[model samples]
Target: MKNKKRARSYPVVQVLSKTVYLAIPVIILFIVVSWFSFSEIRKQNNLAVENTVNIYQTELGHRLSAITHFIQWTVVHDPILDGFVRENHMGDYRNASNELRLRVSDMQYSTGDEYQYFFYWDEKDIFFNASEIKVDYDTYKEIKEKIRSDVKSKEDPTGSFSWKPFSFGGKEFLYYMITYRHRTFACLVSMEDILSPLYSLNLGENGSISAISPDGEVFYKTKEGPAGIISSVYNRQLFPASKSLLPFSLAIDSRVLGNYGKLFVLQVIVFLAALMLSFIMAGYILVSYKKVILPIKMFSKSLSEMDSVSDGEGLDLTDSKIQELNQINEQFKNLIHEITRLRIDIYEAELDKNKFMIHFLQQQIKPHFYLNCLTTVDSMVSLGDIDAAKKMLMFTSKYFRYLFQVDMNTVPLINEVQHVEDYLSIQNMRLSRSTLYEADIPSECNSMEIPPLLLITFIENSVKHAVPPEGESLKIWIKCRMMNHNAMEIIICDNGQGFSRDVLTKIRNGEDMEEDGNHIGITNCIKRLGLLYDNNFKLLTENNKPRGAKITLRIPVNDK
Candidate 1:
């Protein structure tokens, strides 16, 4: 046993030990690369944020300047202003005011809502509207006083405008006041209209944008908060420097800046990939021990323990820890079933040895296999799939008997197709309605002999990767037809996530290296086919239109 253990240990333990050292440096390299990637990403993002803020502020400046110019041009060029201000050409004040308001209707601006228009006469110290517009005078008076106070406080008010929020009658308005050449103009805009642009900007998740007065009062804040408290408290984290929109400067949250969400997700993916690759490399080395060495041990032990032909009849290994043991155990269980079936033939072996040998290698189906099937049947019955489970139970014994009876590991294509259908029926009941499979093969092709479980591998791939999410139907199609020159063609197509280019490439090359859960099962099957067919087979793979993937294989119709 010790010698056997040492013999089995050499390739895996020695190679994996060396490979582990190589993986450490590769892991470190990834970490350094990831660090630099995040740094560069953030550096670029900061530059982008700074540049974007500058451009936005510049554009906003232009927009505000346009509004400033509009107000300034309105006051200076008013035909009626000459009559009212100079006290010379006043025929009727109402008619003049009506004319000025009509002229404003022809104006175009970016804002969707209208702005309040008021004219201030410096000499009379009185305010008058260009037309009768709905505004709460008391609220406007308070906001106007705040603006006047702010303008008075400023050392230089030229080219400057004051704005403040005022609310009345359950509606909020922003009052913008500018003093122009012996007169003042106040424009009232709804608060919603002013903050609409800020709301639309893609400020990162948990980040917000707002406008703050010179006195540090916030009147325009984006309303996305359960953690509004964070914005209130984390002033240090704020990027309060997008060039002032006249009387107020814009503040954006820049502390957690630069697409941190994407960067962190990328880092996690890389870190996990590296870690998984390391483990997979180690796991791949252990496959030789699991597949070859362990099976030899199981067979040797089974052969040794058999005292009589009857003692060998129940040699099933259920004690092994390795998952690979299950396959060898199943083979032994089928072998025992064949022995039980040929018990009477063996008694007559003294007369015809060749006939007994042939009968001893095939099936009667083991009790253990039947017990497992019944247990599964009981489970499905409890889950309300009693009818489907009953049908599967009936097919289970027949499938198992046929599965063991295939003399040289090959069977008629019809039997293989029926086996797959029965398997699908059982699996479909287990995962009710999530997947639907359809098989279409010409009847003439049914007699062709192919390796057992060969086609099922591709079918199983479709099952795992192609199932749609809830409320959506997943469709899988298996089609086969005889091809030219004594060849058979089979296609398995599914409407799943489809294969990635890397996975498709690996499968096409028959390399069982993918750890993506979906790719591993497929390429393993391809590897088996390569061993079986050598260069006699042809395989093609491609992504299907709109969704899913297609796998096509061509093999000789004659099993020989």
Candidate 2:
């Protein structure tokens, strides 16, 4: 045992010992420390850029909020504009317009003339700006039309301030409009002027910043190239008070994160050397796994798969490139072969036993059925109905002759169906009641094979229990169809008194179901199906709605 252990130990241990030199630990430690330091630097730089973007977002949001408040206070809520709307005098209009211009001019002066303001009186067709500049009525109408178009295209229902982008005089301006009682007040800021503060920010050599309008138009961008690691801050996210402001985005290029001034080249060289050493270490580890670990896994998997090898098929394990593993696999294969031979012998014996048990079960129901037929015939003869007795005997004779084909484990589906028809006729004659029988057996499924007398057992149960009202006839249906290329289905149902709850439970639980000679026929049929099909067939029984019993059988088929 010690020799065997030593033999298994040499290949794995020797390969590992040779691969792991003293310098390997030093190199690995260096790589780890360097990676941590480099990652920290990049993380810190990215965090700093994100902080700057957030700060800018806040400041820009505050400025826009103040402007919006000023417009609301001066134009929308002022008494001067309200008087101009209500009064019909021309003197009142002139006074209100002058006051509005003065207020807007003062705002522009205070904000370094960054925003242009306009007030339009819808009643008089008059429009004026902060600079007291007046345009022709045609130009005013064009501007009004543009504002209407922008409002229709980009209206924000959640807020009173509606911000939109509109092109006027070949320049795109961010337009902010607020309409109050048919009087419109608006503010306009050029994209270039709005993003002027962002231009002065020191965002590395390859860093970029952009302002995007609500309609996804890029109002302004500092750099025009492929962006990297974008960080975004929407206007509403930054300033909830001014929900209609523009959104901003910033990106810091990956190349900028690696820049370390004078030490940039040296650091790059070190990083590349560390990455190459990591690859070398990974390659050595993979080689060791292939040489040692993989063979043991294959051996374990082969042993596990041996449980399913029942037909004497060889395992045919591949060569594991190791002498000891190969020898172990060969021994395991030989042991499996012996076990398979014994299993096959036992399996054949069990199969023969199952066949005999099925034949015996089939015979168990015969005596009861034959005795009932004979009694029915005797009753007819005593009543002086000789012709009825003769018809009953003829149907019973045909059914019995079909049943006597005990050697055949399966017969064509059409033959089984014919057998069911004979059984139904015999039962009708015996009961002296009319039965409404319907059959829907498709021609495609006529040639498929199924166990003999399989249909009649369910039909017999139906006929015996199918008790309709005084004037109603017993209703029974047999349906057969091919389920797919590999299976067929048979269904038998009746519109009479369905199965009781207790009997259905017994059938589902696979119990004997022999209460007062009640469910013996169905129980025997289930046992026979089990022996013949193993686990390849399905049988189900249920009580149909509004009074009926249904039995469905799905049988697997093999192509001839």
Candidate 3:
């Protein structure tokens, strides 16, 4: 016989490799999304810096413009500047200076000393600070000298009103001057004071703010030497007010964009961790398949090929890595061996039971029946009826011979009917009464085979129970016919008191009727029929219409 090839199992590595194949596109997608997110973060940071710089520029420009307007108005409207321009004598200067000093002192007292007010007279060659009496002598002298030197060395303004950048003690200030013929009025504003609100701004670790000149020189900065991919906003684009006045620019660092490097590092770490986990899980699955799933498949295949325990004596076995699976395999093999041994024991037990039942049936008819036959035969001989005695002896010999033929499991229907007739004749002669016996057996049914003594057992039951008192005659009917193509039916009935309800109920239910050693003939007949025909035969016992016990048997027959 040609053997069919078994299919190969799928490799676990190939299954795990599919996950790596799927991850390639996912990694690409992740990078693309992260790039867009980084770009958006940069753009938002730039916008925030631009907004902060613009706000600062607007406030500073507004303050400078207001101060300039107020100084110009006071110079044009007050009589102090007119006195300085028209009078040159020291007395006249002193009288006018006293009134001017009182007015300037009043102005300084009205507003905080955020500015230093100065006045200059070209003819008198007098350059002095009008509101300096309140300042410390040394500090005031230092500031006055620096301003005096710068004012003298400085070039004259190209316009009547002009702005200039001034530095004093490392602080930035804007110097404003107004020229009225021979007299000049000017004031100094500290740039640091104007920008003080932004000192507490929440710029990141590597972030800063700076005020720069148009020439790229830093006037003031919050932090020195700021580092990293810092994004900045220029004041020229958002706030143009500072362009004409020294063209200073405000700059704010957007440090949020610089933090992208840390974010990207975190993302890479997470991706690598996930990849490592996937590898571990794949390895686990492979180990489980080899140790658990593979062994189970082998066990199932072995079971499928097995026809019987004896035939499968050499079962395919493999040691599994798992202890529980090995134990189960051993237990399954032991169970098969146990089942094989139990089957032989059960078969021998059934054979012994059949032999014991047959032997009992053979012995059952001899004891009481032999004594009755002897009594009848003795009586016959005593009357000098020698021919009757010989007839009775011949019939008894045939009856005992038939009853003892335990080896003949089945006999032809005609032989069983003949044995029954002989038994009935003996009973009639012994009782000295004639019983009516009729047989309606067809020629076809006479050759049918049935269990030996099956029909006679029922007939004997009728003779024992249905034989009436001396006056009334007993009528026995035996009928046989073909029931179907493969079966025959036999019916035996007798006109007498029918079976009691208790006996009929026990018979129909197939309950034991031989518990008291009674009805052993009928019990043995049923057991022998079961042994011969199994379920293919049917037997029915019921009370006939009118008054009699009826026994019907349907037996399967071979064509021969």
What digit string (tens of lDDT, one per residue) describes model 3 on residues 1-560?
A: 22221222334455457656666765676677577666666666566666666676666566566657767776667776666754367777777667766776766565546767777766677767766543456745655676556555556632345556666656667677775555667777677765676665556765666666656677776666354334342111223334533346666653545444556775775577567657766776786576458766877877777765454564555443334444555677787779889999989978876786667565557688889999889988999998988989999988888777745656788888889888988887788667889999998888787767677778878887784644889989999889787899889999888888988888778788877665667776776677677667788888887788889988898544
Candidate 2 clashing pairs, residues 3+ apart or interchain = none
Report the lDDT tens digits of candidate 2 across residue range 225-329.
334344221111122222433344433332324334534654766677677777777878797777767766876787678668754575645543455565564
Error of 1 at 65 (Å): 3.0
lDDT on C-alpha atoms for all candidate structures: 0.64, 0.69, 0.69
Off by over 4 Å in 2: 1-52, 55-63, 66-70, 73-338, 349-431, 439-453, 478-491, 514-517, 528-540, 544-546, 552-560
Clashing pairs in 1: none
Report clashes for each candidate as comma-separated counts: 0, 0, 0
Question: How much does candidate 2 score in TM-score?
Answer: 0.50
Cα RMSD of all models vs. native, in order, equals: 23.5, 11.2, 37.9
Could you estimate the TM-score for every candidate? 0.37, 0.50, 0.42
lDDT by residue for model 1 over 155-266, one digit each (tens)?
5544645456666445666666666565666667666665565554445556666666667887666644326555542222234434445545666664333555667777
| Winning candidate number (TM-score) | 2
lDDT of 1 at 256: 32
Q: If both were scored by lDDT, which would come out higher, candidate 1 or candidate 2?
A: 2
Stretches of candidate 1 off by over 4 Å are: 1-23, 69-77, 82-91, 106-114, 120-161, 164-174, 178-184, 190-192, 198-200, 224-245, 254-560
Query: Candidate 1: minimum summed lDDT over ten consecutive residues — where?
Result: 356-365
